[model samples]
Target: MVLEDPSNPLVLRNYAQYLESKRDFSGAEEFYFRATQADPNDGEILSRYAKLVWELHGDQTRASGYFERAAKAAPEDSNVLAAYANFLWEIDANEEEEHSSNAQVDENAVLVDLPAKDFKEEKRPSSPPLHLAMGLGIGRMDLVGINQDYIISCPDDRTTLEEYYKRVVDENPCNPLFLRNYAHFLHQSKGDLHGAEEYYSRAILADPSDGQALSLYADIVWQRHHDKDRAVVYFERAAQATPETVFIPFGFSNVLASYAKFLWEVEDEEDAIEEAKNRMPVGQGTATAANA
Candidate 1:
């Protein structure tokens, strides 16, 4: 097919996938890259290429750029969004591990003469005022938005956000949004998987219909603990709850896509995969099946 029409992105991508399945990573990378060049806007091709670069070549920078591009190219694609999110989570986990190793190295370093002031703890910035407004009759979603804004604005200073999140969740212990957000913060910022799992479980207990929380919890269970049975249960709950979660656009579709991918790739369960395909949104199931 490449000999007949080298510019055909679909053919190129298919060939790349075939090579990947055969463990010819180098050949797969070349064809995936060629496919992306042929069709720059194809999010699937871009995502595949990004995964290949990240996993095989260990080029985090290049992979991150490609993943961002893939998300931008297909914002509505659940698979693309999930893949990008997973990539980010993996990066965070890796960085946390590296930081831990570096801390150990620093602890063992030869003592050097230094000023007493150098040993002083740097004072962290004060928590943002958004949490202070909790008593002003602020809505739950409004608080969520405020927290998100603060986190985005102060990406490097998670200490403030952590304090703010802890306060908010402490006051609103039953609020699923607050609990889930706090759980996510613990997972990403504090590298506290166990803490995150506790909060995620609390979030689910607070609101059984919270699809996003369920899905996120499922991810943690699968990735962190490798508990396949528990993960499947949570994923199924997420998919079932997604339809009632009106705030999330295409929520059901996203859950279905994530569930299908989990079954197909992680578990490799044929019956579960078929069931997931049957539940997926119209054309998406066809595409997934074809790719499989």
Candidate 2:
């Protein structure tokens, strides 16, 4: 019935989503392509299609074009900006030698492997990396990661990660997502647990329900601060927030898994660990939980 109106982009998109849910990638792509053709300027549709193609088919060339079109169509849309920025960042991060040097990278320079003009002719083998599929979705975190502050201070630039994060947090001092992501970045990249805690606390204050921030807060305090009481508080709070969260990506799940490991492995609370494992979606079981 939905396909009866082949010209209706909304129906097509919804049908595409249905097909996607059924694991029918070919059918989903067909409907999504039709929807995009009917409404070429729809940034949201373009973004969805871009992600769909990239994740299912590993067609980075097509995905990049769709992302570019989406950004051009809606230049001010935060979601579009976030996804595009993530795409660029992932491309850079995948490159082996991009960030090896201490010397400043030129402001005028761009990633040579991902030249804008060369995307049209790019090709790939049949088998794509499993990691790419595992890390497909873009969440609020991705949007937060692509702040102009992060972009302007390219990895090649002398501006330190701390400096870049400071600029972003300063730009929107009240934004919880920015604070949360910066905290994660600092913890992961700089190993600055103390600095991360400050930002994570600010993030929680700004929006107490952010499970990602709360989870990370629990992680650092438990791991580094050795504050079991404080850590448990945040962990419980994060678990409470999980059901209401939009989605929990693998990275977020990994953090939770770490906390769960701490409970079962480090803290030796098997009952609480089981409860934590049950909170996550099916298939995200805590079987892989390991020390950080």
Please tell me which predicted candidate would have the highest lDDT against the true structure.
1
True-structure lDDT of candidate 2 = 0.66
At residue 48, candidate 1 shows an lDDT of 92
Per-residue CA lDDT of candidate 1, range 55-110, in tens?
99789899989987886687546577677656766666677689888877443352
Q: Model 2 Cα displacement at 206 (Å)?
A: 0.6
Looking at model 2, residue 7 earns an lDDT score of: 90
Per-residue alpha-carbon lDDT of candidate 2 for residues 1-292, written as tens digits (9 for 90 to 100):
5657889889999999999999999889888999999999988789889988887877778888998798668644556656655654454444424456655576566465567645422322122122112221122223323322233223354443456556757887888867877777777767788998999899999999877778888888888867778877887677557542133343333434544555654435556777888897876664455431
User: In candidate 1, where is summed lDDT lowest over 10 consecutive residues?
Assistant: 133-142
Model 1: how far residue 78 lies from native, Å: 1.7
TM-score of each: 0.43, 0.40
